[model samples]
Target chain A: GAGVSQSPSNKVTEKGKDVELRCDPISGHTALYWYRQRLGQGLEFLIYFQGNSAPDKSGLPSDRFSAERTGESVSTLTIQRTQQEDSAVYLCASSSSMNTGELFFGEGSRLTVL
Target chain B: AQSVTQLDSQVPVFEEAPVELRCNYSSSVSVYLFWYVQYPNQGLQLLLKYLSGSTLVKGINGFEAEFNKSQTSFHLRKPSVHISDTAEYFCAVMLTGGGNKLTFGTGTQLKVEL
Candidate 1:
């Protein structure tokens, strides 16, 4: 792909419903990340994947938030029993390598919990 | 631990005028600083970064920033502004020897008017 791609650009769901956000990173990129941006809030790191090593999940806010990545490619973030406070923009980004300082980001998926 | 702070939440300036967005970061070790711009309805795009060598770093769209180690700041500046430059700016820091996750500031909204 020319750039990072995210699916379901906008999502609306009732509270307690589970939502899945998908991210397809740039071709051949070796690193992928997930972040959340609440309204008027800073970008919050969620998880990171580098090659086949263990992902950095320390940033996950709660047990309800979980993410999975397939190698260095597609990544999915799932929020179970979503809360109204979970309404925010979910962003995905990728870099060529872990050491690279710059990142390429997706348009982001806006989740609106009702 | 590493953190970034964008001093101003919003800045409005007339077109052709110069503008500066202040940013300060706290880190205990070597770090990389970066500025990212997010246009309305779009993903974040890298503006510039200071990794190593030369404190002044230039980036696309005529944006530049200087890394000041003494004050632990990486403020963004532009000699001239345009209406098209209106966007949300984020300052971020990544520890060179730690995980690849970036810590981002709350962001500054730059509004350029005529």
Candidate 2:
């Protein structure tokens, strides 16, 4: 794709249900990132991946929240036992490399856990 | 650890008037600065970035920002704002070589009105 792409632009689920958000980074980009944005709030870093380096899980809020990226391609963020507080927009971004400061972003997936 | 701060939650400016959105960051090591804009129902796009060269950086839509190391601030400015300029602006910081994790601020809502 010309830019980062995300699936399930909007998702609505009941509390305690599980949800998965997908992100497909720009082709050939070696770095990918996931972030969460609450209503009217700033973005919160969730995870990051660069090449073959160990994925950064430091930003994951809890064990219920886990993400996996296959090589330099598609990535999935799964929220298990979702809570109402999990309601927010999940954004995905990709950069050419870890050294590059500019990031291309996806439209984002909005999750509403009721 | 690095963090960003956006003091103004919202800034209302009249059309064609000048506007400024303040951003501050704290980091133990050298860092890169960036500004991103999010339009309604859209994804975030990079406005500008400061790496190593000049302190003044110009971005799209006639927007610019200055990186002030002394004050740890990267303030976004526009000489004249249009109604289309109304959007949410975010400031972010990335570690030069630490882990490539980008930390973002709460964001500033710029409301350009008539």
Candidate 3:
């Protein structure tokens, strides 16, 4: 794809249900990132991946939240036992490298845990 | 740790009027600065960035920002704002030597009206 792509642009689920959001980063990009944006708050860092390995998973809010990238191409963010407070937009971004200082963003997947 | 602050939650400006969105950051090390704009129902796009060269950086849509090292501020400005420019603006900071994790501000909602 010419840009980062995210799936399930909008997802509404009941509390305690699990949800999975997918992201496909730009081709040949070596770095990928995930962030969460609450209704009226700033974006909070979630995790970062270099190639197929995750060097930084320090921002995952809880154990219920886990993410993985395969083949250095596609990534998935899964939220298990979702709570109402988990409602937010999940954003995926990709960069040519970690030091590029610029990132290409996806449209984001909006999750509404009711 | 790096942190960003956007003082104004919202800024209302008349069409063709000048506008400025303030940003401040705190970091222990040298850092890069960036401004991103999020239009309604759209993804975030990079407005501008400050790496190492000049302090003044120009971005798309006639927007510009100045990186002040002493004050640790990266204020975004526009000589004339159009109705189309109404969007949410975010300030972010990334450590120069650190990984690509971006610390973002809460964002400023610029409402350009007639």
How far residue B100's Cα lies from its native spot in candidate 2, in Å, is: 2.0
lDDT of 1 by residue, B1-114 (tens): 899999899999999999999999998898999999999888998898898999999999898999999999999999999999999999999998966788999999999999
Candidate 2 CAPRI category: high
Per-residue accuracy of model 2 over B21-84 as CA lDDT, tens digit each: 9999999989999999999988899899999899999999999999999999999999999999
Candidate 3 CAPRI classification by DockQ: high
Question: What are the lDDT scores of the predictions, listed in order?
Answer: 0.93, 0.93, 0.93
TM-score of chain B of each: 0.98, 0.98, 0.99
lDDT of 3 by residue, A1-114 (tens): 599999999999999999999999999998889999998899999999987664599999999999999877999999999999999999999888644668889999999999
**Fraction of the reference Cα-Cα interface contacts (below 8 Å) that each candidate reproduces:** 0.85, 0.75, 0.78
TM-score of each: 0.98, 0.97, 0.97
In model 3, the runs with Cα more than 4 Å from the true position are none
* Residue A42, candidate 2: alpha-carbon lDDT: 92
lDDT of each residue in A23-82, candidate 1, tens digit only: 999989888999999999999999999889899999999999999988877999999999
